[model samples]
Target: MSFKEASKQRGLYLATVARNLRLSPHFVRLTVQGEDLERLPRHGYDQWFRLCLPTGDGPVDLNALPDQFGLAGYLKFKSSGLAQRVAVRNYTVRQHRPEVGEVDIDFVAHGDRGVAGPWAQRAQVGDQLALIDQGRGFSPAGESDFQLLVGDESAQPAILGILRDLPRAAQGLALIEVPEAADAQPVEAPEGFEVRWIDRSQSPARPGQAALAELRGLSLPDPPAVSAYLAGEQALVTGGRRHLVAAGWPKSKIEFVGYWRAGGAT
Candidate 1:
């Protein structure tokens, strides 16, 4: 591989800024574009990146640069630096069009009440964030004839990434849990695969009451490999894994992740 390609293979500290867009009632889209794109590491399916923002920066304007280096420039404002940590949770790269050097991250906009959500709520074109992390690429799909993907809003980005990476012939089910009827939207997936969404958050993540139910009742096809990936609320994820394994999935063929735990997970 060329040096340029090799450099793009590793995560770099993006000292740059990008524009933002409100995507849905619960999601905000941050579009970061700069020369730093030349160094963005290629990561796994559903990988996340660290977005370090200052707690003091006020509202931002999309049409103009914030008279300095954007949020990155806020460091000089108070104590010569801003509060930093790997605080913001992991988010999926919804679209990575390297050809144009633009990547999109959809942040769950929880009515500007969340730390990250509110930050994204007022994000603008001149807003700068120190992106210092990138997840390893999505888990390798099984060489089997089919696959299964499960998750809720938090896990949707990763699930969607995997689906878009699948071959046209891959077959399986992708069961997702969103908020209400309005949150449900058409998604592109392999034609052979079935996509189902359940509105469970109208109340709360019910520990797999809906997903585990549907997954347990399904008839899985036999193939060289049958992989199942379950992500979302912690309790629900655990139950899904147990149910899948009990249904005959080998431990090696299943991947379960707790994207979030109920009862005030930070």
Candidate 2:
């Protein structure tokens, strides 16, 4: 949890799937709606939450969610046999339209191997879901000369959201890796901000490999200060940070996060 604990705007919100759309062969967009979402705080950049969904064909009581937020609260609920019937996962808030009381979540559908991916693949409009707001991770103090963003598939939504919120005068570079070329989408960015999309459609390497390889080969600007945001597989985040530091970037300027592990990609 790279998120700030004190910054969490905790709340148990009930959301029903309003629609599901496939953005690519590996991306599914789910629109969830509820009046409770109207009250959800907008932290913008990399805002995420913990989702509670029905698990393993078992009956679930949406109201059975833990009364508290954080690890202890989740563990308490899990100890009571709720873990079997409840599926928990953390997801980024891709879009939040408070006026419509709707939040859009983009899921990386890798296949039927994982709980969340399968659920998103076949989710219906009326399917019920629960979530606890955990707030965001990207909070810069506006001191950097430029920014650097790098991530694999899982971090796409977060990186995209960050790009959306950046000022028009911002200058930076964003490297986003996807499983296939079809997964790449047009992203809005400042004129000086280079958004590079790395396609690993023919690579035998796993997710995050392409991004890491690209970062190693990239030539960064000679700026006074740079803010780097690295996310996705553990290796990618750590490896990317190491590469940056070796290239003269300050350790304090980089925000590295392992959003998921390669072993769990299936």
The top-ranked prediction according to TM-score is 2
TM-score of candidate 1 to 2 decimals: 0.76
Candidate 1 per-residue lDDT, tens place, 15-36, comes to 3347777666666778877666
- Misplaced by over 4 Å in model 1 are 1-10, 15-17, 57-86, 201-209, 222-224
The Cα local distance difference test for each model comes to 0.63, 0.84
Assess every candidate by TM-score.
Answer: 0.76, 0.92
For candidate 2, report its TM-score: 0.92
- For residue 127, what is the lDDT in candidate 1? 60
- Provide the clash count, candidate 2: 0
Question: If candidate 1 were superposed on the true structure by all CA atoms, what would the RMSD be?
Answer: 7.2
User: Which parts of model 2 are misplaced by more than 4 Å?
Assistant: 1-9, 56-59, 141-144, 222-224
Clash count (model 1, backbone only): 9
